[model samples]
Target: MIVFDLACQPAGHRFEGWFGSSEDFAAQKERGLVACPQCGSHDVEKAVMAPRVGRKGNQSGTRNATSPARTPVASEALPPEVAQAMQKLARMQGEALKNSRWVGDDFAEQSRAMHYGERERETIHGEATAEEAHALIDEGIEVAPLPFPVAPPDETN
Candidate 1:
């Protein structure tokens, strides 16, 4: 996997996206599958990122406590336990979404409707802007972001 720092157009909301490769990123973006989690915008572009290079094992240096530690690259191998945990989490999400309805871009509206008793309360999963989600929480409506991105049913192969 490869990780890229991405920023959405106009809103400029920044986030990290993981893809199998640069080609995969291009393909997804072309298909409008890549979108800003914050604003649900598909107009996104790669943000300038500094390359991460690890020091040699023999290199020893005094590091300031205030300095940030290097983060692990997504392409690196994961510990077995970590990998298993991620798989388990994915399975759990899948199970939970099994009975959930997909409202696509109407997530916030639908959630609001249900919250206000305008619509029957039911399990739902869909896209919502960060602002919308914040507003939902502020209104005392229960909402949570999915651990992993879900492909819209209409876009699934």
Candidate 2:
């Protein structure tokens, strides 16, 4: 099995998919069978791959690196009202997170704690690995990923 990082053109949500071979990936893509799980977009393509060098202790120098593929959606293509709504949503989220604590990488844990009543519920936003977010969802915790990445607090200054 081969894993490919695929991105859907026209919202850039990156994801990984497996295929029988490179040809299989192409075939599926051509048929528009591949879709972005995040946005259900079919305009998918291989994401840019990064080069990696093997360490001295590693036996094989070759390594496969995959990155999350994002689906691109042209915001300009949307109706003005829809675009305005999206902008409003983004602005609302930004305003909400402004006074909220920036927990950095502790997003998942902190969210879980609040869900389980281990920590007091308060506005917060931070980073969470995709897997961690999935786990949180599975556990019935209410967590929503941010539409855009936020710089860590320490990195801002």
Candidate 3:
């Protein structure tokens, strides 16, 4: 007996069927004797065979098992569109932050002072909690969260 992997066309359900031989399977299919066990549909065909399986150390009649995983080399590699977009955004952010000062944890306080005219208004970006951001917005302060986290300048060294 032979086992054939069959798939139903309408529902795309795969199943195995037993037959006496290859000719037997073909005859049964031609005569419309094959039926999908799930939906009783006669439209069925053999499913695509997957990769072969064998013992890990077995090397006979098989491709090399020790080859390194494929990695795209420079010049041959292509940058994804999203990667290009992110690069452009990073460039824009770097330009924006070129003149902005980092206030570390005192982002909310300094921002509030600038907003209320207690201090001169200037471009600034720093860490602020969700609650602090919400409070700033509630008090009519314009604050936007940075798309990425920044390391404090003092910590970089």
Residue 123 in model 1: shift from native, Å?
A: 0.3
TM-score sort, best first = 1, 3, 2
Cα distance off (Å), candidate 2, residue 47: 5.6
lDDT of 3: 0.78
Q: Which ten residues in a row have the lowest lDDT in candidate 3?
A: 73-82
Q: How large is the C-alpha RMSD of every model relative to the true structure?
A: 13.3, 11.8, 21.1
Task: Work out the TM-score per prediction.
Answer: 0.57, 0.49, 0.49
lDDT at position 150, candidate 1: 91
Please provide, for model 1 over 1-109, each residue's C-alpha lDDT reduced to its tens digit, 9 standing for 90 to 100.
8899999998998889999999989866764678876566889999999876778898787776899999876554666776787799999999999999999989999
Instruction: State each model's CA lDDT, in order.
Output: 0.86, 0.76, 0.78
Clashing pairs in 3: none
lDDT of 3 by residue, 39-121 (tens): 66889998886634565665566557797767965432335765676578788888988899999779999999998899999
Cα lDDT for residue 125, candidate 2: 84
TM-score of 1: 0.57
Q: Please give, for residues 1-157, the per-residue lDDT of candidate 2 as tens digits.
A: 8888888887887888898999978765654457776666878888987743447774655544574556786433656776687689889877987889998779889998899899899988887666787898999988775654466778876
